[model samples]
Target: MISYFNDYANLCFEKFGDRVKYWITFNNPWTHAKVWHSYNKTWRNKQQGMVGISLTSAWGEPVDLTSQKDIEAAERYVQFYLGWFANPIYSGDYPEVMKNYVGRKSAQQGLGMSRLPTFSVQEKSYIKGTSDFLGLSHFTTRYIIQKNYSALKGPSYHTDRDLVELVDPKWPDPGSKWLYSVPWGFRRLLNFIKTQYGNPLIYVTENGVSEKLQCIQLCDEWRIEYLKGYINEMLKDPLTTHMEMVTEIVVPTVFTLCILISAILLMFLLRKHN
Candidate 1:
């Protein structure tokens, strides 16, 4: 599977390297990531373009701040979702919390060793220092709590994490039932990426809200306000350094996006200046 990615990216570099200056190796690390490996070895010396990968995660807020377990649960959620992929590329191995918890769960399930897999010392050396930048996609926030349920009896990825995710009912609902506007989570996730990944060159590969398709309203006031809140947060925060771009996409019925079009241009300028 990885070999296929390696072949395709080499073709891309050979064909389009002169045009495409920035390259993202994969959408998520659970998928292909050979471009960074390939580019650094072969194409990068000639192409001179940067290569990185994209990750998506939600900010997990502790359900009970005073509870140490809940605090760790919140941190663990990010590590499992974001750090599971990013940590290996940045630090050359899985997060220690993930190793300990998953390994313990695997043992309880009667496995001789962790089902999560481990890398060789040489493999770690190869994987380390592979990426030049980091791309991330984030939306919303979830309240996390220690899992105390029978779900842990299984050995899937979620069960091993031993955490329950929830949300605040009072959060603002834009247009989609699933997506609530949580601007604060955006900053939290960004800061986490900065600290966890040594403040690498950051690009918000995807960031936006969804509106229900039942109404084809051209003047999307809710979306405008949502962008204002989220983009303003990124502008003021000093933690999210080297931010390249905040990409967005909206799904709806055929309608001229006169309002969102204007909002997007304004956001581009704001992002450029900020």
Candidate 2:
């Protein structure tokens, strides 16, 4: 780690200098640490590994909009899931409130020094504005409530927050068993990024739902519906379409049936004309 840092830092100043404006040292270290490392000890220690801190932004929607308890719980769930990693990258530290609420035993066992890693003075300075653009990978948001810790079992980070997540049965489950439609969470996440990081350039890196099965047809009405809602919400904020060309770009997909129809038509016309 030390050698890599020294090498990169030296290389940056010597060769790249002003040419290299952004540096993303790590991406998705949460899944890397929790899932990969937790699963196997040897795999965790392997060197020459790319340790990105890219994490799933588990946005939560309040089941009851008017209820203050539900509102607070929704906010708490956001802090526990999304804010846990995003806060550190932009702000240079973990959300202290989260650490306190997670309880002592959690600190000792699964997340010893916090699942969110700490940064040194030098590291923070390097990382703070390191991103030329913020990247967000999202799927669906879970609904959460402040349930007592007794309900949860296992030494997992989910239990640490003392909050339980629930998915609305109404949400159409296409692929993954866990994901549910919580459209508002996308808007909230976008707003949070704009407000927190001085409204830095953002790239919605991964923002679509999956059907998992290959047998699913290309006429994906559900995916179309998901994209339309989320994109419309995103468009509501003008700042999202700032001094950047990214938002303007849209690549249309060629449906499989359309391709097949075109091929068949071409063949039929060629034979008839010939």
Candidate 3:
């Protein structure tokens, strides 16, 4: 599979390599570190195009800020999700917390080895520093609390984390049941990535909400507000100017005029009320 992917990538580089400056080798592959090394070795010098992977994660906040266990669980939540992939690409191994937890669980299950994969010293060195940039996709935040699950629950990803995820009822739910408008979470996740991975070049590959109700609303006020809040939070970071962010919303030409008028009228009304 890896060799096939490499060959396919080589063909792409040979064809559209000149115009395409940035190429994402994979979007959230389960075992991607090896592929990164393979791509870098084969085509980096020849094609001169950057290769990166897109990782999507929601920020996890501790349910109780003062509770140490909840704080640990929140960190664990992120490590299990984002760090599961990012750690190997940047630091060359899975998070220590993940390794310890999974190892303990495997021991309890009478397994010889942990379900989580391991990398050798040389492999670690090779995998480390493989990505040119980190592509992040963030939308919402989850409040996490520590919850102990029996080892009998067995070697599953959710049970292994031993955390409970919750959401605030007050948070705006525009459309998707899972997606809430928690713009602040976007900033927190970005900062976490920056601190955790030495502030690597970041590109927000996906960051938007979906409408649950099927209707033709040209204004798309909810989406507009969502983008406004998230983008504003992103811009608050001084380093954000250096990063590349992408968000796409397609509006038809007929709706374009209607949206412009609505926006102007809304602003005017707000100003008059103020």
Candidate 4:
């Protein structure tokens, strides 16, 4: 299955490398093999193109900062989400927590071998240090804590990480169950990326707020504030914030214009009344 994807990407590279300067290969060991070969061996030196994987994470704040279990669970949240993909590309294997927990669970289930696959030295070497940059997508934040569940509930990716996620009631939730506007989490996530994978070059690939599909939300007050707060946090460090340039500048400008106009109209009415 992996080889098939590799061949497909290679075909695209063979035909399109001259025109396409950047690429993002999908996940999996085979995915990296194809992506690295396509860029490093086949096209990068020739075309100077780049290849990376797009990854998404929600920042996990420990339920109790001082509690070791909560802190470990918070790290597990990252390991399960971003590290599930990033670790292999950057560090050459699955996270230690992932291996340990999965292996222990598999044993309890009376499996002959661990359900989690071990990487061969060759696979690890080939996969390690393969990515050119880290492409990240992050949203909101969650308070995390440790939980132990029965493997009888079934072996699944979600269950492998024994953790529970909670959110603060005070966070400004813009009606999406999954998204809460927690801007400060952005800076923490960026810093984590810097420290975790040896500070690879990072490009933020996606971020969004969910809203009911409306024909027109011209004022767009909710999203504007969300972006404003989030972008400000990102700027606190020298990291990135995402969106199209038009929306990035224009939305805020429009918002400021509306506030100014409303304020002026109010003053005009007050003076007339007086």
Candidate 5:
């Protein structure tokens, strides 16, 4: 699969290499190290483009500020989700909490080795600095609480974390049921990434909401507010200088183009009938 993707990426670099200066080899590759390494090795010298992966994760806030267990669970929540992928790329291995928790769980389940995979020293070195930048996609926050699952529950990704995710009822629910507007979470997540990964170059690849409504509302006040809050929160972080609100730009442009094409087709059909 790595070789196949490398071949496909090389084709892209050849065809659109001049115009496309940035290439994301994958979007949310839960495992991006090897593929990123392959692309960097094959094309860095040949192409004038930057290669990176897009990782989407929500901020995890502790359900209780005074509870150490809740704080640990919140940290674990982010580690299991974002760190599962980002750690390998930036730091050359998985989060220590992830390894310890999963390893201990694997043993309790009568497994000889960890459920989480390992990398050799050489593999670690190769994968360490493959990415030129980090592409982050964030939406909302989750309240985290510690929840220990029995080994009998089986070895799975969810159970391995031993955490429960919750959301406050007070948060604004614009349209998407799952995505609650928590702009403050965006700032927290950005700062966490900076601290976790030595402040690597970052690009905000995706951040927006979906409207669940019966009618099309062009004004979209909720979306505007969502963008403003998120963008403003991001600006508060000194580490973030540039961000690409992809959905904000792409969706509206596509919708407008579709409407224009439909109107043109309607005009042509009316003339033909006349």
Candidate 6:
């Protein structure tokens, strides 16, 4: 498997060269690091970040903003769920805060290091800001609670954040397991990226709803609504307007008007002759 992946990476570089500036080698390895690695050791390594892992974040909300525990847990959840992958990808480092919470037993057994991969000094420079545009795939986030360390399952990498996650009972469900109606998280995440990652170019890669068996085909009203809400938030970002080009919209309108006036004048002259 490692050989095949190495060969594939070589093939991509050989064929694409520097032309393919934006390359997504891997995405959402956390889900695999959790479920697959739990069952099979071989599968875990096979599925690990051979290229890189996308820290696909389900940006959760705090149940009680006023409560210190809730706020800390919410931040922890963000760090564990999002920071776990992002920290390594950008800074080539793991969330040390996560290591402390993941507990001792699991840490010794390799579950802690199992999920997070360390980069070589060379790999660190290669992976940092490798993306020409950061494409984010987000849906909904869980509201987190600080549960007892014993109450948590698996390893330190999993529970180091000291947060247990659940869907907001009050938030309207979009029918998927980890998804709920939370557009604010999307905005918050964008702002976080801009602030943390020096405002790189961003593209909303996957933002949608699970309609379930309620409908056969994809009408996607929920997706449309989600985009509208989040896009409005993105526009509010101070950097968003920098890319806003007046030339593209205005040039076409001006050209069309000039053509229409010329055509109208030509027609009027022909009509007078008739």
lDDT scores of the candidates, listed in order: 0.81, 0.61, 0.85, 0.81, 0.85, 0.61
Model 1 lDDT tens row, 1-274: 7888789888989999988989888787664445677788887778789988888888999999999999999999999999898888889899999998889888888889998779899867778777788888877788999985443468888888889998898888657666788888888888878777888888889888876445655867777878888898787635623332221222231234776788899999999999
Residue pairs with clashing backbones, model 3? none
**lDDT tens readout by residue for model 6, 1-274:** 5455545655665465445434455566432222112212322233332222345677766788888888888877777776776765556555666655554435655553544455578765644543434557887867777766652355554544667787767776666766777878778787777776677666666777766346677777766776677677657635344335345555677899999999999999999999
> Candidate 4, which segments miss by more than 4 Å at Cα?
27-30, 212-217, 238-274
Let me know the TM-score candidate 1 reaches against the reference structure: 0.82
Give model 2's TM-score versus the native structure: 0.62
Clashing pairs in 2: 26-52, 27-52, 27-53, 27-54, 28-52, 28-53, 28-54, 29-52, 29-53
Writing each residue's lDDT as its tens digit, candidate 2 over 130-187 gives: 3435567777777767765642355566666666678878777767676665677788
The worst-scoring run of ten residues by lDDT in candidate 4 lies at 237-246
Pairs of residues clashing in candidate 5 = none
Ranking by TM-score: 3, 1, 5, 4, 6, 2
lDDT minimum window of 10 residues, candidate 2: 31-40
Model 3 agreement with the true structure over 1-274: per-residue lDDT tens digits: 8677777777877788778978777777765565566557776787777888899899999989999999999999999999998999999899999999998988899999998878899989978888999898888899999999888987788989999999999998759888999998888888889889998999999999896567765657788889999999998834333223221223355478899999999999999999
Using all chains and alpha carbons, the TM-scores for the candidates as numbered come to: 0.82, 0.62, 0.83, 0.81, 0.82, 0.64
> lDDT of candidate 4 vs native?
0.81
Model 3, runs deviating above 4 Å: 38-42, 239-274
Residue 100's C-alpha lDDT in candidate 1? Answer: 89
User: lDDT score, residue 69, model 4?
Assistant: 93
Q: Model 5, range 1-274, lDDT digits (tens) per residue? A: 7767777777877788778878776788855565556556766677757888888999999999999999999999999989988998888899999999999999999999998889899988977887888899899999999999988899898999999989899998658778999999999998899888998888999999886455665767778888999999987725433343445665678999999999999999999999
RMSD of each: 12.1, 12.9, 10.3, 9.6, 14.0, 9.9
* Strongest candidate by TM-score: 3
Error of 2 at 35 (Å): 24
Angstrom error of the Cα, residue 206, model 6: value is 1.5
Those runs of model 1 whose alpha carbons end farther than 4 Å from true positions after fitting are 31-33, 150-152, 240-274
